[model samples]
Target: MNQELDSAAGSLPHDNFRCGTVALAGRPNVGKSTLLNALIGFRLSITSPRPQTTRHRILGINTSEAGQIMYVDTPGLHRGAKRAMNRSLNRAARSAISDVDLVVQVIEAGRWTDEDEALYAALVEQSSPRLLVINKVDLNKDKTVMLPFVAELVAKHSYDEIHYVSALKGQGLQELEQAILQRLPVRPPVFGEDEVTDRSERFLAAEMVREQLMLRLDQELPYATTVEIEQFNDRPDGIAEIHAIIWVERAGQKAIVIGNGGAQLKAIGTGARRHMERMFERKVFLKLWVKVREGWVDDENMLKKFGYTD
Candidate 1:
């Protein structure tokens, strides 16, 4: 894995500078990944419209003159997780918030569901300072309507601070950042100034391919699929050579992923390769294969092998 910091290492952390880890906790489809990317000023975590798209605890680092904030983007804490993989996701999400310096509960503006309430209950048990981030505020044209909802919410719940912002449009983030920095303890930076994340290119490669699967596959098919990077080698020719396998539970699912005349597979490879080149900052030669791993999602050992467990 390449851990080299970029040339522009930015300003060093000065006296009284605050630094700590912050966990973006929320229910599924609440735009936590988008908020993480926006806060870091880098596309470190993959995003899709699907729920539970983030299955791992990904750390994104943002270093500035003020301080270095290590943001942990976690999987959504959802209910009714019957499968082993789903259970693992909840464990990862819960584990991430336990050790973080601050917990930011992100939810869509003007709406709060049962899942949101469930996650809030979990956050109450944590010792970290909690903040409420109302994301997707841009979607609500009638801003006045939110006052009653927020009022009712504050009446029943408690938060150190509440902020409204649209993660997609990058709105009202400066205030949120300042509030977060103020809450963190004054300490030196833990990561290099130029580092955006601790994740390696190898892990990111699998995620890029899985993002494509979540976007292109229909219905429940995406949930049954996972990506494995069989090989990720930076060739002497200056091109990243990647070999990946798309694991499905059934042969029928494998046929669908491969598609007629291999067109679907081709499209997945093309899309994932383009993202890899941009994120890796190099040309990529990607090759993909679809394989059937019967009942991998429910098998605990298989889930661990696929990097689903913490």
Candidate 2:
């Protein structure tokens, strides 16, 4: 691995440089967001066990002495009856594949199914330069058993390379990162050397809240919930004030988010605030409010207003 890194390092130009985008594409809940966070060394994208937690194309920038890699984390693709929001999310995910220099197709280590094949087919049809990334390897009891199958699949699909990584455990990620950097097109860095992600602090705050909601809520409630940051204020004392609204599709869903006498909401707030403080490395005062936005998923105006539209 050191030799490989040395070879890649030698291949790169000597001057400060930036590379193009690398898109993370896969089915829902396959650890795409987690992998992006690992690659960038920060949580630029929100992650949960719930499918489709990532609804937008989030860019995570990694700057090093070698170059910069802008990782685009998109919503997971799924087959279903089309709703306005679903269509938008799918479109955003698919669109990332076309323009990016490299596409990282994340697949669950033990959960390969027909849907993954279909996604692979669609991805292949685009003729994009791609890599097969088998995620969640840490959860596998027999990693060697899956490698041959992954190798065959990669051969069949004609992918540029294959990487097995445990995103959550940070296993085998350095290889993945080196491979990504090697494959990226050489150019000047698109963002500042200090910038990690393109998303605004408000956007990340909202996503952190939504991630907590998804983790805490049960059943369909998690799927029906969305978070929006209404206001953010930075104080002089190294603290920030954040006000956000958690919108649910129905009144019952709203009640669940608020919890029995607001216990649940408090729990969500506490979890989200802690994460915010850790990410920002400062104090965060998060104000969360529950609102019922009926049919927000289907309502075009509501979806557009919340930055969910295409």
Candidate 3:
């Protein structure tokens, strides 16, 4: 049977077969979204240094002459004090690990913590085929510094394989792609050839605005903010009109978002409009309004309305 399996793998037409799913799991700020965007050759997911930036499971698909590889970008796993939002995010992250053809556990090459070890242990206990992906290799001046640590972890955990790559710089991605494709089960393409992501345009637009706000705002401002796309329309003149609402937790928060003489809101709108125009490939007229929605994040109904829950 071993010989037959090897022979079948060798004879398989790599170009004709469709690949399978590879889930990207990690702790917050470990660059999972960056890796996804880099692999798919586009910015499908909004990335920020802020933790819990990705609240949902985002699918990024890569198609080649060989086959298609679907990568799932999950929310970062974090230890919280049993808050509803925290619990939901952790559940979303773990959900990606189960029932997937391959699991790619992304870890920061520069840091090794007990938290990483705990998560690694859980993944191992599941007996799933997995790879330890060491992201952010570009930051390491001496790449060999991580080699010994990676080897120790692999030996201790008995991982199926270890892959080292700088996801931000696109290093070692081809090899990683080959490793993923080699493990994927035989299947047909799950989506069309032209589709790069599973998220809708409205979702992307809202995320883009949220990402900009997160980048621009400091203190508690980013945490208290939520963005919703109220209207999106494309005209025959190749222009897209977008209206979005930025919700804050308090009236004071609303004032901060609007800024002195509306400076901050205008800045966020300008930045978001440039990105939206580039993404939609048309002129974007974005209208943003601020409203105070008290306790929106913790409110279950509000969370469901925002698609954080179904």
Best by lDDT: 1
* Candidate 1: Cα lDDT at 166: 93
Q: Give the winner by TM-score.
A: 1
For model 1, how does the per-residue alpha-carbon lDDT over 121-164 read when each residue is reduced to its tens digit? 99899999999999999999999999999999999999999999
lDDT of 2 by residue, 1-310 (tens): 2555455545555564548789999999999999999998987788887888899889898878788898999888888837888988888877888788888899988667776887787777775688889899888898688868776775667778888899999988999888888877667656666679867888889889988988888887887778899989998987899999998988888888887889999999999999999988899999999999888888878888888854
Candidate 2 lDDT for residue 292 = 91
Displacement of the residue 152 alpha carbon in candidate 2, Å: 3.8
Q: What are the RMSD figures for all models against the true structure?
A: 2.0, 5.6, 6.1
Ranking by TM-score: 1, 3, 2
Which window of ten consecutive residues has the lowest lDDT sum in model 2?
1-10
- The whole-model lDDT of each prediction reads 0.92, 0.84, 0.83
Error of 3 at 299 (Å): 1.2
What order do candidates take by lDDT, descending?
1, 2, 3
- The residue ranges of model 2 lying beyond 4 angstroms of the native Cα positions read 1-18, 236-238
